[model samples]
Target: MTTPGLAGFIASGEDSQTCDVVVAEVLEALGQGFELLPERGAPRGGRRRTWFDTFDWRLYRAGLTLEYAAAHRGGELRLTGASPYGDAVQLVTGWKASRPHQLRDLPDGPIATSVSGVVAPRALLPEVTVTGTTAAYRLLNEDGKTVARLLVEYPAVAAGDVRPLPPRLTITEVRGYLTQARRAARIIAGIPGVWPVTQPLLADALHAIGRYPGDYSNKVAANITGRMPAAEAAATILLRLLDIVEANVPGVLRDIDIEFLHDLRVSVRRSRSALKLFGDALTAPLAAPGTALTGRKLARFAAEFKWVGDLTTPTRDLDVHLLDFEDTVRTLRAAKPDDLEPFRAYLKQRRVREFRLLARGLRSPRFVTLTRDWRERLTAIRDSANAGTAATVRSGQSRRAVVETTGTLAADRTRLAFAKVAKRGAAITPASPHDSLHDLRKRCKELRYALEFFAPLYPADSYGAVLADLKRLQDCLGEFQDTEVQIGEIRALATSMLAADEAPAVTLLAMGEVTAWLAARQQGAREDFERRFAEFAGVDGQRRMAELLRGGAA
Candidate 1:
């Protein structure tokens, strides 16, 4: 009958020309059972409102809406529920016009906490603006207690704003007292042209405009089918990855969140991985003119992506260091967190400088040239596949060796990776050198990327199960390496700080404590490796991965 997430109401009407007389008739139906008391300080006139979402709409998918309106004073900065029917909460903060609310503008409250996790690393892309008049009234019961709220809104699309939902009337039911809300619901239900809002206003806003959030991700699978040629498949995958690299640049440059650089680096890494892991398939000779786009030109593009990746490494590593600084200090048991502030400040300063360097490079013509050249190369590769298929018949070359589908090509690559990982996994023992385990981690990462790139071609049930098990093992390995690396970097940073005489004596103590804690954690990850590895390489895990590689049922 009514819901909370979609702005609770007794009933609603859409697309009907609402007026004072219409509202009066609807109120008359309720009679003396309820009284409408209009708030004295209600805002007048229509205000331009804007809702922000990731390109992919992550918040809405998570049942949250993070909104900010430049033209409204009431609830100008808001986090509301994006669901049609749920107990959605709206947390409000006033909008400061002189300086709009950047991610930092949100105070430490429910809105900030909820949004920080979802929208970080990506700036909020505007979804839509509802420019319309709003008239709100409180519904009171016989005891003079406010039971519900009715809002009559006439929304229109302003010039240049995203247009989707139209103006409407909404009755929001206050929490508790469902009986009173239902009684009120019955009265409004009797009116013609009035109906319940089947869709969330925000959801409708996006859907009507054919837009959604979450435009980018770290694990974006290419839209390649198993039936496509190997080169075509590789190009398809790489092209989408290039788009991810481009999409993340703005966020990275803006420094909206650290995750922007993290994501951009990951896309860069995947490109490098794809080139290395699938180089043979991509470079194989075909019937098309000259060789498929490879050799020096391909190597140059790989070098550029690698260069971008190298630039991002230090800042992201320091970000992780800062993120764990508190927990590291906590591990000291008796140490006051204040002692670590100096070290934390040092890290922040270094990170700011490092990020600025990275951002500058990202905005440079070199980076722009690299992206354009890479896109052009990948596009050329796709065109080669198309040309090869057509020329095979005219040139009298067998399609068998040159034009294999993604299924065979991916299977061969997965086999190569599995063999490497299997060899590495089999060689691991309690007495194995730390270097060996580190090497295995790198090997496992390659296998992980291979599986991810070709996942769509495998049976979901089998592939998903295998990926899950592999992920568990990968997580263990990641922790081991990260801890080891973190411990070293912390110590190195500590040494530099002390050498430069940049930090106080207490900061030295704090650094020692953090280094000790990181060392202990690194050891823990090392000690726990055999168990995690065993689980990952268990008979069942291996069986599922084997099943997936065999192209079992989806």
Candidate 2:
């Protein structure tokens, strides 16, 4: 489709001894065979102006133009142009920026020169007439001899088959046209009639050539023709690209910023959605990479890059840690001789670990890679869910049956995964890293709930009790896990500060008290969960529910 925009070129230069050199370079760059128009004199009323008869420059820019007339006077500059949507027309009395009188008064010479043309709007087909005009003015020095020259060109063409033109002009084309007009104006002004020129005509010409359709409009059209499933995909991609440009490469390129990392996450999400929406069009090679990168890789990256995301929370956590550590250090520093050494050692170790974790997270490659991978996995899962839904719908089963079947399958898979996690948890030794064991337990809870979502689809009498029990267990475990995490962080902070040799004795002692209290809290949470699970298991609810479902009871 023809993009609704316009493109053209303009060139202007001063009329001086150096004018020939500039004009020659412009013409060489623009190529040969462009027509030139006859020159004209300055406007009356001491207001200098010039016009061109005819010139042919390339259509390099197209866009809308706005015009306004001077309220005091009837005359105005008629601005005609194009934008992404349609043609533009503007009329104004004054120029955009005023020229210095000293520059304007360089002995009366040609005051202005311009070469302008328009790319036929999309509405015009096959054959369209392109018309342009150019004019020149001469300003005389006080001696009455020509000291400056001005040239302006209005070039218009009546041509057929211009429909084959590109939707927008290239940068090279626009630059060449401007160069030529400037050179040409300089060359013509050397003749006695032209002097005292302004470059406004050149500026106008450049603006005219820079007009063209915007990228958004073109991309939208392309996506529609290409049968993209979601209209938002193009917008999303564009936004993501803009984010990358603005964040990572605001001025100089190289090295990703924290903002860039965040933007990258957003882009991956949108790209994944696009891929799934247009899955039919995407080949395996294109889709497989996304899946492969996600999962384990993404999980690892999230852990490593955890610091950038941690900044807000970290500052707060650090403040609290510092305050407590400082109090403890003060106490330890002023403590009785019996407690001094131990307190000092503890303070020293804590600082080392906290700073180390902070420094490592900021520049970890593994973290970046894992983040990319996780995004890939998320997209893959979303795509798979969509595909699975379609397949189920097409299988000719009743809606209820289809839903039930899919739910059951999903629940079973989750159950199996979580069962493995629970089994692994039992083997976790006291020496095992807290994060590893904690993550495993968390995964178990996720699996349990993933199964519960399908409970309603199963025979109510059969799975109802099981679902309820699973939910109860999940809630208990979730709380327990959270408390555990808090305690870990608290302990890590306390230890780091103690090791730093900076925390006071009082701060160290207080942190120790807090750590002990949290440990007690953890014990209480575990005991509560244990008691609840024991009651659930002994009630025989699972067996009763199973029998009811198997018997086909409502």
Model 1, global lDDT: 0.73
Candidate 2 residue-pair clash tally: 108
In model 1, the worst 10-residue window by lDDT is 4-13
The reply for model 1, stretches above 4 Å from the true place, is 1-44, 54-56, 68-93, 96-127, 134-154, 157-199, 207-210, 285-291, 387-402, 552-554
Best-matching candidate per TM-score: 1
Which tens-of-lDDT digit does each residue in 1-554 have in candidate 2?
11112122233334333444443444343233233222243221222222211111112233223222233453343334433323332333443212211122112212211112232111111111223323343333334433223333333222322111111111111222444334433443343322433323333333344422221121111111111112122222333333442333221112211223334333333333333232222222222234323334434433533434453244334433443444434543334434434444553454455545644644366545544544444456435434544665688645344332333333334445445554565555545565654565555554443333233344555556665765676566666675576567756756666566556766556556655655776667566655545433434743543453333212
Worst 10 residues of 2 by lDDT: 163-172
Top-scoring candidate (lDDT)? 1
Candidate 2 regions off by >4 Å?
1-405, 417-440, 448-495, 535-554
TM-score of each: 0.79, 0.31
